[model samples]
Each structure stands twice: as structure tokens, then as C-alpha cells.
Target: MRMKKVSFLLIALVVAAVGFFIGCSPAKEPEKMETVRVAEVTRSIFYAPQYVAIEKGFFEEEGITVDLKTTWGGDKTMTNLLSNSADIALVGSETSIYVEAQGAKDRVINFAQLTQTDGTFLVARKKPEFFAWEQLKGSTFLGQRKGGMPQMAGEFTLKKHGIDPHKDLNLIQNIDFANLPSAFASGSGDYVQLFEPQASLFEKEGMGHIVASFGKESGKLPYTTFMTKESYIKNNNETLERFTKAIYKGQLFVDTHSAEEIAKIIAPYFDDTPEELIATVVDRYKSQNSFATNPLLDKEEWENLQAVMKSAGELPQTVDYSILVNTDLATKAMK
Candidate 1:
């Protein structure tokens, strides 16, 4: 019995010594995060994939730290990209196309396409049981500045229905997007076109209701894309690749999940909005297929967007497609 007790003590001492060495040994180092500053063109449910990525910690998973800054409008957002204040500009691909057409020294090259569907909704001041685009013929519609995507889209849709956006409807220009909903609610404009949550928010408050969905009308336009200077793209290949992979994962997460699930994930990132309204807004976007499944901004969509821009007189000249888009990075990201 003594011999057995001595053997047991010896085993215990060996185990204790092993454990002590393990405890004193160095731990595995945490990942050092890479930073990527993104200048978001506009804050809306349209860019839900990006918001989902940020909220779900996908950036951290990829060892990337994303600093998302909202620049309110695409013009300002593109400027941020031009000045090197932002590594990527999240705006319509047309903005970059225009820059290239204008002969910018460092042209914006689109790498990733975030959304494929137009996110604007034309909300009539009064809700109508039967909706039609022709109903807007004589109405004074609130619109943005000429080159803005929402205004251009609104013009495109109206013209498609045989109504002259410039002559058939009185379009009020240069209205701040923030004031559009309230301005119409206060009987300032007969109709107002705006991005999600605002349209639903207006509907929720009984101020205005949707008359037309631009996404459904526009049918797969290149709505939102991520671009950077050609020099930046050539230099920071690894950082951009990792960032794309993380956000592309977020895009897939959104595509597979229900609107309600994504709404909960992205609610905190948007303006202080209630979950139900967020869900409603998300459902509206989901129904229209607003997001792209991958980061690829294909040639067909790019051409379609340029056509729309040219139709609206926003582009001075057509740029060579290869010069404006570099999909190789996006391809690497997915792999």
C-alpha cells in the first residue's frame, strides 16, 4: 500500500509540473487588425450588406478594421475618394464613370458592386388604391440635383412611361434629401422620391405612401458600387482583397437570411429606428432584390448604368469599360 501511495504521489507531481509549465508558457497572439476607411455615399437600407458586415463583426473575422463614414451624397463621397481621405468610395458606379469621362488624373475604378436594384420609391402625398406611373404626369415631384442617381432614375422611369420628366411633371430641384419627406408631408410637393426607411417611415406616419418602386421599374441597374483611385487599387491589393471577402460574406449572410433576421442585425447601424420598421423597410428592399450576391460589378450592368447616366445628360463621354472597372481584385477576394 505504501509503494502504491508513493507511485501515486510521483504521478501527481509530474502532472502538476507539466501543468505549471503550460500555464507559464506564452499565449497565442491576437490578430493585428488592418484598417480600411470607407466613405459611404448615402445612408440607407440599400447598403444593408455593408451595415450587416460591420454589425456582424465580419471585418474583425477577416482581421480588418473598417471605418465607415457617411458622406450624405455621392458627389461628396466621390470627393473623399479623390482626396485620399477614404480608401474606398461607396456610391453609384456612374459617379466614377463621370469622373473618368471628365478626364480626372486619378480616375475612380469600381471594384465591387454592392447593390443591383434601385432603392428609391416615389411616394405620393396621398395614398391611392390604384398606382400607376402616369399618375405623376401633372404632379410637382420633388427631385434632387440633376446629376444625382435618384433624380436621374426618377427621370428615366417617367420617360419610359411616355411622360416627359422635364415637361410633363414639374420637378423641384436641389432639395436636401433629409427635408424631402417633411416637405411633402407639409404639402410642399405633390410627390417625393426617397430611399428606404424614409418611404416606409413616411408610410408608417400616414404622411405619404408608395406609388411606384424604382427598383421594380428600373430592373437591375448598377445602383451602388465601391471604387478607389486606380493608384490605390494597384498599391493596396491585399487590404482591398480581404475587405471585399469580409463584405461579400456579409452579402451572402443577407441573401440567405430572412428580412426580419437581417433587420435585427443591422438596426443599430442605421438611424435610431425601431425593429419593426426596419424589418418593413428591409422586406421592401428584399422583395425588389436590391443587393448583389457577390462583389462583381459585371460589364452588362456597368453598361446599363452608363446608358442611364448618358440619357440624363450626366456623362460627357463614354469611357472605355476596362479603364473604369477592375474585377480581378473581386475575383481574388471570393477565392
Candidate 2:
């Protein structure tokens, strides 16, 4: 598409401008690096704080070498934590609810939360004069799998606007995340919920136009968080504290820096996307306060996430937030 081509051109220009300057800059090295395996659900701009920490040597400065894995979905990322393949997982806070539902003996606990609101934005194939939640009635929408926050957020946004998610729209759930763009291009659905880079990428291709940011209707909901098993957090307090400290620094760096600057720093992770588009995506997130300033979990927002899931029957029993999240490490990191 013409728009996608333009996006690629813009990235080329930005890369040419900053690539040389950054490549020549010295990368800070740590005297000793302690590798920590962290499983991330997705490599998205919404998770920019972690990416910023990785790119800007914040982790290295904390004497941590990060082994970041992209599991592509929250369930798998949580499994990484459950199986001990990963030391920690950066996942949707809603994941904690699902894990609690399973009643594992060594339950995973969240010590830090990064995204306080849903990062998903709605994209429609054709732009219309009036883009409203009610407009989705009678339309087919490409939604994420059940239990994932993206889909749950979409459902919440619909209900808040007086549209019943079950009765108002024909929702599709079988599409793989990586195939969403192609699926959209083929007209499988009229609307799709996506995080940054994917949403920005589709917009660049002129395949779809952003209709609504679900965050507006969903309000402040706990989106993504960092979690480890109770035993791991208990045994590796120092390491976990250092990780939070570095991520906290990353949050501050993103807040103080321009979107373009932050984009450049994390550009390597988004190499597939045009730098210009990635910067645009970062600007959107910056405006939304998508990342948290500190890792400490917000009680009210976490409750909202649980409420959303319980509304959908994804959670049967009430979950106590205190048991699932701890603030001491993040508190110490802040101090």
C-alpha cells in the first residue's frame, strides 16, 4: 500500500540520520553481569519501559544481563514463570487472576506493575464520519483469545457504551496474533483491537484507521505487570529489587525524554517497523501515561481488572489482591 511504503521511507530517513550517531556511541559495560531470564508476552511499544531499560543500559548498570523471551501470549509467559524456565515474567495483571483460578501451590505473585490502563486501540478498515462504540453493532470484530486483557478490555468498552459484547457484534477469536494484519487486509473483520506497533503499522499501511482508544472507556485498569513465584521473590529479593530499580529508571527516562529520542534508544527492538511510525506510536503511549512511574501495583486498578474478568465468568472465586501482589520490593527500589 502507498501508506506503508511512505512509512518505510520515513524509517529509512530516520535510521540514516540517527543510526550512525548511535552506533558510534559507547555502550556502557558492567563489571559483572548476572543474567536474569524474563519472559515477555509481546515485544510491543506498550512495554516501552522494559525496552528502554534494555536499550539504554539501565539493566547493565544494575549489573543485570537480561534474557528477554517473547512468548507471544500471556498464558505462555505465565507458564514460563510456573515452570521455572524464567526468573520473572512481564505479563498482563489479569494473568494473576487466571493463575489464582488454577490454585497452584506455589502461586505466582506480582511485585511490580507497568501498564495501568489498556494499551489496545480499535482500528476499523474504513474510516467513517462517526466512530463510536455503538457503531460496532452488527459488525464483525477481530478480538484476542478469551481471558487475555486485550479482548476483555474490548468487551468492557462495549458494555460501558450500552453495547452487549455477545449480542451486538460478531467477534472472531481464532486468528493468530502474528496473522492479524494479513487477516485484516483480507477483510476477515471490520475492526480489530491491537497494541502499539501493530495498530500503528496497520494505520501506516492505510489498511485501517484508529476508531477509539479503549483506555478512555475502560478507565484505569491494571494492564501489564511483573511477577515471579512466591519462593523466587522470597529467595531473590536483592535481584528482584535491582530489576525493579532499573525498570523504574526506565519509566522516568521515558517520561523525561521526547518520543523520538526514546524511540531511537529502543529502535533496535522495533527494527521491523519504520522508525517514524514507531516514534508516532511512542508519542501516543506517552500522551496516554501508558507506563507507570513506579513498579508498585495500584489496588483500585487491579480490582477493576478482576471485576472485568468476573463479569465475563473468567474468574469464579474472589481473589485477594494482597496475596497476589507485594509492594515491598518496589517500595525499596523506589527508596
Candidate 3:
């Protein structure tokens, strides 16, 4: 009887010791996530891939939490990046060239291309039965900011059609970027150049008619891209690679999915805009091949962009494409 009692006591002591050790042991911690602050020039259906990446959890899958903010304009977006308020910037590639021209200490580098073509449409108060470029002559044209990518591409297309933007039309560009749509709705110009959702919404509300796509007319160029400071790339190479992987995944999703499917995924980003309008804008952009299929910024497209800038007399100096662009991360992300 004593032996049985001793054995039971020994067993109970062993069980208690195991339980104490198990209880005292540290618990497994949750995985740490890195947050990347992104400053985008504007929020529109034009940047559908970015939205798709965020909405579909591509960034999260890569252990990244995106903090997206619209800085309203390219200048503002770059300002946020330069001041360290943003880890990455989604703006026109021209902004990086502009910063390089100014000789920034931490030069902005174009890492990934998002939009390969201009994302603007020429909207007129009245739609002609058969629209012609010649009809823009002698009319009041509301262009974008003087040296912006939209205005540069618009002028490039205008010159291609043999219409001198400065001489053939009464051009107005003094309005702020945010006020352009309202200014047009308030009866400001005979015609205006607008981005998506706004362009489609204008048509839906009978405020304006889309006469032509500057994107289709201007040909392919690296219009909008993702950029970051040189130091950021050097210090956070791994993180940037993960970010690029997420971006490439987003680009692939946009490439494979239908406009309606994309619209459904990205609707949360543009909460106010109707899903139908978003889909319409997405279809319009997709039909023109405005959205880039990949994140690689092509050398040919970069040169074409500089050509447009030069045509607009906005090229400070021809900054070497090698100096301003880094495709290493994008290439690695593809694999």
C-alpha cells in the first residue's frame, strides 16, 4: 500500500513540474509587420492596380502594411517623399527628373512604372457629331498645370495633330488641380483635360463630353511611377523588394482580371464614385492600354517621356535614365 501511495505521489509531482514548466515558458509572439507610408499624387481609377494590391491583401501577404495618402498633386507628393513624410511616392516620372535637375542630395529614383501612358481625356461642353482635332483651334482650352505630365502629353498630342497648343487655342492653366473639375462644371472653359472618374462622372452628369483620349493620342511613355529616395533604397533594400513584389502582383491581377472584377475589388477606395462609373473608367483605361502590365520602367518609355518634356520646353537637362531609374527590385520581384 505504501509503495502504491509513493508511486502516485511521484507521478503527481512529475505532472505538477511539467505543468509549471509549461505555464512558465514564454508564449509565441505574433509576427512583426512593417508599415510603408505611400504618398500618391491623386486617387483615381487610373491607379487601379495599386488599389487592387491593397484591397486584395497582396501587401499584407508580403508582410507589409500600406499607409496610403493622396497628396493631391505631383509637387506635393514629391514634397512628402523628400521631407521623409512618405517612404514612397506615386507620381509622374517627370517629378523625379525635376528633382534631379535641382540637384537634390538624396536623389529621387523611379523604381517601378505604374502607368505607361497619359491618363487624361479632352472633354468639351458639346460633343460634335464627328470630332476632329482641328475643331479645338480658336477654342478656350482648359489644360492642366503648365509643366505637368498631363499638360505636356496633351501638348505633345496636339502638336502631333498639327495643332499648336500655344497658338491654335486660348489655353487656360491658372486653376488649381483640385479646382479644375469644379471650375469646368461652373462654366469656366469651352473644353478641359480631365482624369478618370471625374471624366466619366462629367459625362454621366451631362457636365461635359469626352471628345478624345490624350492617352491614346500621346503614345506610350512612363507617365506615372513609384519612386523613393536613394538612401531609402540602400537602407531598406529588402523591404523595397517586398513592396515591389506586392506591386507586381497587383499589376498582374489588373492584367488578368476584367474591368468589372477590378471595379468590384477597388470600389472601397473610391467610396463616393459609383461602381459602374469606376468600371467604365477602368474599361476606358484598359482599352487604351494605359495601365502598365508590369512594374518595369522601360528605357524606351523613359526616353519618350523626356522627349515630351523637351517638346514642352520643360526639360532642365537630359538626366541620364540610369541615374534616375532603378529596375533591380522590379526585376527581382517578377521572379
* Higher-ranked by lDDT: 2 or 3: 3
User: Across residues 1-335, which tens digit of lDDT does each residue of candidate 1 receive?
Assistant: 99999999999999999999999999989979988999998777778899999889988888999988999888899888888899999998788877877779887888988999788888888878898778888889898667877777777777788988889888898678788777877788888888878888888888888878888887677788888998997899888888899889999999999989998888887658888888898888877788899998888887777777777877677877788888898899888
Itemize residue pairs with steric clashes in candidate 1: none
Q: Could you say which candidate leads in lDDT?
A: 3
* Residue 37 miss distance in model 3 (angstroms): 1.0
Q: Give RMSD (Å) of candidate 1 vs. truth.
A: 3.5
What is the TM-score of each predicted model, taking all chains together?
A: 0.91, 0.88, 0.92
lDDT for each residue of candidate 3 in 214-269, tens digit (9 for 90 to 100): 99998899888999999999999999999999999999999999999999999988
Q: How many Å off is the CA of 64 in candidate 3?
A: 0.7
lDDT of each: 0.85, 0.85, 0.93
The local lDDT score (0 to 100) that residue 128 gets in candidate 1 is 83
Model 2: lDDT equals 0.85
Give candidate 2's error at residue 284 in angstroms.
0.5
lDDT of 3: 0.93
Against the true structure, candidate 3 reaches a TM-score of 0.92
Clashes of each: 0, 0, 0
Mark the 10 consecutive residues where model 3 has the least summed lDDT.
Answer: 195-204
